[model samples]
Target: MNARLPERQASRALLIGSSRFSHEGLHDLPATVNNVRALADALTDPALGGLDPSGCRVLTDPTTPQQVGDAIDGVVNEALDTLLVYYSGHGMLNQRGELFLAVETTDPDPRRVHYFGVPMGWLRSALADSPARNRILILDCCFSGHATQAMSGTAPAVSGNLDIHGTYTLASAPAHETAVAPVGAQFTAFTGELLRTLRQGVPDGGELLTLGDIYPALTRALLASGMPRPQRLGTGMADHIALARNRAYRPATPSTVKPRTVSEPRGTTITPGVRSTNEQDPKVAAEFHAAMLDGYRRAKKELNYNAGNFIQMVQQVGGLEAARRLLRASSVSSGFTTLWEKGRLDLAVEAVVLQDRFAGLFSDEELDIARDRLAEYGYSPAQTS
Candidate 1:
């Protein structure tokens, strides 16, 4: 499991939005402004961590690298406080293999980066030397994954809950892939999901959203949205460093906890990995659900995995009613959990069909294991005949 959260501390955020650039070839990224504002609002909300607005600094379209550096210098020296640096703009890599954040007056030419770009190496050095107990760097720009490799080290998606007391970096895309910001969307693709994770809260039975909770959710959210996977990098006292309180969530109880199963009339209570008490027979559907949990449990042993959160995410993205429709449509009078496991009849087709129906909820490994197990039993997922 990820280490438990460290003590709460004073939190401050620096949000940089560069929508308008001086270079003629570069187009303005209007979503940058939207991304910053949305995040800033979440940070300052009283129901959240109740962060002081004065501690948050947002810079837009800075004219030079010095301006960005000055902003970084202001926050890096802060001690025993949580410091967040978020950049939403264009990012580029120069010939010298340095990652740079494009300044407002940045020249987009690939060869002449020193003119208007802020070196990521400089940013990394400042963060490494910081005295603050909590440090987070979030980059929502192109070539952001490069910044992580430039840092300490890149980590796989966090499995267990842990406090991120040392330093953590979240990059929107890999070193080569381009990040996305749909033209009409209010915020950039990555930031939109970040804010959603904060607002929706993890179902991990806590008011605080930690690094482990956010990264996987962001990964799944981006995959569902058809965007490149986000990457997390760095290591040091990495545990539950609380980012924000989950305002839209409350701990599940015997009363409010919904059954994550198909029941007679389909009662409104659900949790992952277990069934709820509801009468009525949808045994086939329930068997399918059981198979899903079986596959998932096998895939996530080390992680303090919460199947419910993944289900909750699917409900949020596709709507609860839509999910109910799926359960009902897929339900049958007779069921076969044992046969399904043994790859009997069309169980492979059945599993694949179910996967296609709710493809968003699974991670790559979980899906692969499920397929592999069925294949071992002579079940071909694609061959219905």
Candidate 2:
């Protein structure tokens, strides 16, 4: 059994939205504005009392680059437990592979325009200097991948760096792709789906769900909704960071967490040597057991049943236990039983079948034990004919 770890403290988030323009004349920034509002709503929503929005803050306006920089610096300097940075606007890249966030003052002039967006290198520095255990950087603007590329290329390798222990960065599109916002949508498809998943809650093994479990679900949902695959820019550390930071952000009604099952076809017969298990679906499980029994019958009739094939089917359906019984009953080398036990169920089944076929082995006592086990597991061992 796995031991439980100590619970970490809650996280803090910093949201920056730049919709108004100071120089490049308002670029019709509805998406960014809406994203800011939506996030604010979710945090302040009484339903999210667990999140504790009092510590969170949002900054958006026609500010100078210095003001934007100061806001980021102030938040990181506080050294909060978890720091989440969300930016919704434009992103650009220079010939040097450097990335920038386009702020209000960013010049549109192709030759002389200066990009005011946040530099990923600078962001990494802030995270590295902060005391926060986990850091999440989410960019919803165009050219999101560029930031990831910049960080991966230039960020320091120190363990305490925000880019190390608990750092996660998610981009909406590939490095060169454009991020499109559907009409009437509050945010881009990726962001929308992410919020929806978080709001609905992530699914875990049973009723308990965590942020780690939600990432894959969100990825699938985004793909199903026609959004491009969001790039995962970190390692296991990224998952740890997101989970530790988002623990305070839980959903009210968690999604279902049922395990998957395989089924069998209809009209199959079973035999005494046939074995099955409760691990799989009833019908499919029965079908697999029936196939194993049929194989033995065929070998008895034609004197040429492929033991290898029978073992394979059993392994695919039941597991090592079933395969061992088959091998022992077939009078195959019992010496291989220990080896098969150590192998994967499928592999063990294959080994048993191969041994049975080449050695022409039979274990009557073992077969009888298998048949009894099948009956105990609720499988029918009698053939219809």
Candidate 3:
């Protein structure tokens, strides 16, 4: 069966990552903090997870179990379709071998684990009680595989009470294994791989990436890298839920340009990847350069565009070609769609590039793409006024 994407409007996500710990026994995991922030960005990205930013709550280094519990309760109550809860950091097992999620103030002493750490049973209870039709739990930490066991009613922690219907659990490691976190890495081993999978996307996978598609790939990649093999448990159609858009997906109609190698005045080879800055016709490049700067300013002032890489790209590729590249994209560029979603596509650089005055600069196929994308969004050239 084909996986279905969750309703972006009705789904909610809660991301919790404990990066710092007060007790010296529980070493700090700096990568966990970056994991939460980066995962949040990837999930809310317009072209990726497509989740509303407001619906995805991120908690880093939570102070208390109540804080995390309340957040989970809030999302569980609000979400009518799907509820996703992701936790990355330390996972501790008390004297009874029950799993507890460690927080900033959690004590390594198993006796006091209940005081600060959040119990795995609490999550099972919340999921079992939630009205949402789909529930997804992702854990990235030591002994995370115990979560799968807990959900299956085989674990001593929440024995015989794992009645979480329509729930899916993805764990970073087996119950007895400790998840790897390499020193100086930006994110933990499991979460870093997850982020990479989400961003780089599966080249041969379907347009929408489901749990079934991701888990196998993650397992192969992690095991190949000498990391612990991840585990998964899914009930009902939970495995068929789509989590992200395939970044490597191609449209039916191709818009790729085969570049012709050109030599500069000094015999420097300009390949497809090398963009010309100063060698191009000054007049043509200057016109587009001016338009680009104007639109950049307008987008920043009006649409709150804060992407720093955009300016860097303009400088590297030169404004004239940069505008043309956006126009030639098979689908609307994410940056342009971001502006359109902000209710200010009229001020976008793509809009300026598509103007009649600059029509001659771009090919007919390229112009068609730019116009089609705007029209798809119900945007008109007259909207510029």
Would you list the C-alpha lDDT of every candidate in the order shown?
0.63, 0.51, 0.77
- Model 1, 67-169: lDDT tens per residue? 9999988877753467788899998877765578887888877788867788776667666677767788899999898877767533232122333347888
Q: Give the range where candidate 1 is weakest over 10 consecutive residues by summed lDDT.
A: 329-338
lDDT of 1 at 220: 61
Best by lDDT: 3
Model 3 scores a TM of 0.64
**Model 3 bad stretches (over 4 Å):** 161-165, 250-385
State TM-scores per candidate: 0.63, 0.57, 0.64
- Model 2, 138-197: lDDT tens digits are 887667776566555542322232336656677777777766578676776777776766
Full-model lDDT, candidate 1:
0.63
TM-score of candidate 2 against the unseen true structure: 0.57
Q: lDDT score of model 3?
A: 0.77
